[model samples]
Target: MTKDFKVIDEYYEAGRKALKSYVTGFVLAIFLTLVPYFMVVNHALTAQNLVWAVVLLGVLQFLVQVVFFLHLSRNSRSHWNIIVFIFTVLIVAILVAGSLWIMYHLNYNTMSDSPFNTNEGYIPQ
Candidate 1:
């Protein structure tokens, strides 16, 4: 048997209001995303510049959405919740970094010139 606290209804109300308050921000984030995507496809931005622009803007927009919609501020979470969030973020960072490192080394390792490489092997004819 679970006990339903009286504050549950208030929590639900706050969640609803927060969601409603951020609809405009959500729409703007989507618009910003599509604007850069279309700009790149149209050749308005060079490939290298577009890559950095997209990465920075994507990260910026993600942070904006998180802050404005999720209300994640210094006081938002209790100590336990903050610790959990930090742990989860660290795990995600490790996973992404490790995957990138392995992938980069694999590509680097496979690029060396070697006689055993099938394309460079001796002709049998």
Candidate 2:
């Protein structure tokens, strides 16, 4: 029947689109990964710039995996999954940021030149 044929065509189209999305995502992820690797391996960027570049590429790669591999989108019917994922990401980001902030302050406050370090005899001239 025509209806059956139409359904098959729709499925085929959907499959083709999914395949394209996966392929595109894969290529983009690979390119993003390689860019950072090459930059680091070749020492093309200064330390600060390299760190920023790698962070940016890592974020992009995460997005690519989420959108393509995880099949997350605004139009998805299951909103709960996306909501949970976002919540998890927020929690993780908060934890990581807090940890980094704590570590940085500790390092800055406890440096050899700091009054506390010198007073405590923790740092030798």
The sequence of per-residue lDDT tens digits that candidate 1 reaches over residues 54-80 is 888888787777666655653644567
lDDT of 2 by residue, 1-125 (tens): 99999999999999999999899899998998899999999999999999999999999999998888778883668698889988999999999999988866666566565455434324442
Candidate 2, residue 76: the lDDT equals: 66
Best by lDDT: 2
Report lDDT per candidate: 0.73, 0.84
lDDT of model 2, residue 113:
57
Model 1 lDDT vs. the true structure?
Answer: 0.73
The positional error of residue 8 in candidate 1, measured at the CA in angstroms, is 17
Deviating ranges (above 4 Å) for candidate 1: 1-21, 74-79, 111-125
